[model samples]
Target: MTRDRQYSFRKVTLDDLPLLAAWQSAPHVRQWWESAEPYSAADLADPKAARWIVSTAGRPFAFMQDYTVHGWEDHHFAGLPKGSRGIDQYIGDPEMTGRGHGPAFISARMNALFEAGAPVIATDPHPENALAIAVYKKLGFEPAGPPEMTQWGLILPMLARR
Candidate 1:
């Protein structure tokens, strides 16, 4: 699908719960996202956490999440600078996988963040998620350090783009 025809991103709202839950439950999407808990409407209700729905002509296609890293001590990025932010995303529709949407969507989001004064962003995917790792790398994210158990940290430098 052409870029204009295939995707759009909008701030997620409470009305998007059902669509988000369904996407989170898809087998292909769950493979890389298998965690014990499921997301709830309350989770997406937090104003401090930014979430977006990736859609095509108003239909949900994926989910993207971002949050400030201040005071975070999470395993994925325990060593990052205090002001850094975390970004995570998933393409919910199985058909959209392997079609290059990941890179485009992420790049779009990163550009927006940088424009909003974000200095750096980070993401950590399972080391075995080669497709995701490659897509992040192709968008100019570099391996931040040696792989840690389960999570591989990657960083994108915003100033480098200036």
Candidate 2:
């Protein structure tokens, strides 16, 4: 299927560090991310993580990462399909919030992950993030279980299958 023309994804690069740091520090992003440190080369070099900058008409606005569930021990998806992958994303540009980009770009990326051999995909959003839960449901992701505590905090587990 053709990706929606509204957005694109490109592997994040060192050149994007400053931009990414600025975005990470934005009030909207920081609220959920709960991080104050700027991103570093080491963070970007995580071998198990596929990181990308989500853009719209060539303007960057979001960050996304996908990793194999097995790569993270004790992760929520450990018992699912062997090739299961998990996704984490945030729209760094506050102005872009409330737009349709969340579901559009996520759906596009999820398709790519499936094509790359992921039989299942999961995402754990903060349990109170109603907007994110709604978008995931709209994209056909169903609740896998109740909210669970994780190193990051409490998340509502959700899953999608190919």
Candidate with the greatest lDDT versus the true structure: 2
| TM-scores, each model vs. reference | 0.79, 0.91
Clashes within 3 Å, all models in order? 0, 0
Clashing pairs in 1: none
Please give the RMSD to the true structure for each candidate, in Å.
3.8, 2.2
Error of 2 at 63 (Å): 0.7
Candidate 1 lDDT (Cα, 0 to 1): 0.70
Q: What lDDT would each prediction earn against the true structure?
A: 0.70, 0.86
Candidate 2 whole-model C-alpha lDDT, 0 to 1: 0.86
Candidate 1, superposed: residue stretches over 4 Å from native = 1-7, 36-38, 71-83, 149-162
lDDT of 2 by residue, 1-162 (tens): 235566788888888888778988898888677666655788778877888999988889999989888877887778888888999898988898887788889998999999999999999988888888999999989999999998778899999999
